[model samples]
Target: MLSIGELSKRTGVKIPTIRYYEQMGLIDAPERSSGNQRRYSRQGFERLSFIRHGRELGLTIEDIRELVTLSCHPEKPCGDAHHIAARHLASVQARIAKLKRLEKELKRISILSDSGHVGECNVIRSLSDHSHCETEH
Candidate 1:
């Protein structure tokens, strides 16, 4: 058996986050020691590591929960996991496109401030009035 602190250290997950995962039903509540401290099995360590990896990949908690359920049924097809990854990939791509548009708008506005005075600053003017933007960010 491992202490909660040891589990956190091994998994690179914070102690508070481990508790939150327990509350969220992402990981099972660990057994307590005689002194009331949490004691975790190797299975708990593996589960927490899985949760950490899923979170690092930007998977939503609900998605992670579903994935965990899917993991338990190894005989099932992997289509659901593929679908989840595809959806997340699309979201990431859309955000990247939006960021590119924002970058372009910033570049255009940044070059507009030729005057030393803020009163005559096109950058400030462009920001105050969205109409000056060539593209929607």
Candidate 2:
């Protein structure tokens, strides 16, 4: 068994975040020592590791919950996990596409702008006049 500090250190998750995960039901509540301090098992360590990796991958809390639930049933099909991953991939791709458009727009604006007074700034005029942009911001 490990203390809360030990678990936090091992998992690289903060103490409050560990408590928040417990509150969110992402992790099971740990057993308490006679002093009423939380004592975690190796199982907690593994679960927290899983949660940290999921968060790093930008998985939603609910998505992580579903994955955790699915993990508990070894006999269950992994189609749900695959679906979650696909959905996330699609979202990421959409954001990438949007960012590319923004990049093009910024480049266009920068190229159009000449070093002039702010009163006659091409950048300001282009920003005010949406017709200057071909992309839908």
Candidate 3:
């Protein structure tokens, strides 16, 4: 058995995060010693490692919980995991599309401002005019 600090060190997870995981029911509660100090088994380390990897992959807390549940049922197909990844990919794609539009708008503004003063700047005029942006649509 290991102390909470030792478990944190072993898994590269912060102590408070581990406690939060416990509160969230991501990791099972550890056994308490006579002094009420948390004592963790090797399985705790493995569980924490899984949680850390899921977090690094940008999985939401709820998604991570579902993935952990899926991990326990290894006999089942991984379609659910694939679905989660696809959803995340779709979100990233949407953000990229929005960013590309913003980039185009900024480029248009910058090109129009080349050696131009603010008083007669097309960039400022565009900024003041919401009708000029495709994004406002």
Q: Which predicted model would earn the best lDDT?
A: 2
Off by over 4 Å in 3: 97-132
| Candidate 2 lDDT tens digits, 1-137 | 99989999998999999999999999999899999999999899999999999999889999999999999997999999999999998988988998998888778768853667889876677679878555678
Query: Best candidate, TM-score-wise?
Result: 1
Give RMSD to native, each candidate. Answer: 2.7, 2.7, 3.7
**Candidate 1 collision pairs:** none
Error of 2 at 98 (Å): 1.4
lDDT score at residue 27, model 1, on the 0-100 scale: 88
Report the C-alpha lDDT of model 3 over 32-130, residue by residue, as the tens digit: 999999999989988999899888877789999998999899998999999998998898788899899889888877786378688889778878988
TM-score of each: 0.81, 0.81, 0.71
Ordered from best to worst lDDT, the candidate numbers read 2, 3, 1
Q: What is the lDDT of candidate 2?
A: 0.90
Clashing pairs in 2: none
Tell me the lDDT of model 1 at 135.
Answer: 65
Candidates' C-alpha lDDT: 0.88, 0.90, 0.89
Expressed as tens digits, the lDDT of each residue in 6-67 for candidate 1 is 88889999999899999999988889988999999989988888888889989999999999
